[model samples]
Target: TVPGIGPVYTAGIVAEIGDISRFKNHNALAKFAGLTWRQHQSSKFSAEDIPLTRSGNYYLRYYLIEAA
Candidate 1:
């Protein structure tokens, strides 16, 4: 069992992320879960801090965050 992830959260995450083989890697899975940081680089100016994209499976993201 995961630290904070209960059965419901695990089920939700599994349901939302059906067929895990579809994703190429963990990065792809993270992107699908909307847990990736946004790109804040432009030419010579790069931002040190960036926010999450928040663009993907809402339920999955919610469960993951709540579990965390």
Candidate 2:
């Protein structure tokens, strides 16, 4: 198990992410957990303080954040 995460959180995360094979990699898993930063770019400008996309499985995100 993870250092800070307990059994319940681990189970919740696993349950929310039914099939691990569906994701291509860790990045894909992060995206599914809504833990990725949003893109903020234009013609020649890119914002430095972009927020999270906040899209995807809500329960997974909640479990991950709480565990952290």
Best candidate (score: TM-score): 1
lDDT per model vs. reference? 0.93, 0.93
lDDT of 2: 0.93
Q: Give lDDT tens digits, candidate 2, residues 1-68.
A: 57989889989999999989999999999998999998889999999998889898999999999988
| Model 1 local distance difference test score | 0.93
TM-score of every candidate: 0.92, 0.90
- Where does model 2 exceed 4 Å of error? none
Off by over 4 Å in 1: none
Per-residue lDDT of model 1, residues 10-35, tens digit only = 89989999999999999999999999
Cα displacement (Å) at residue 39, model 2? 0.9
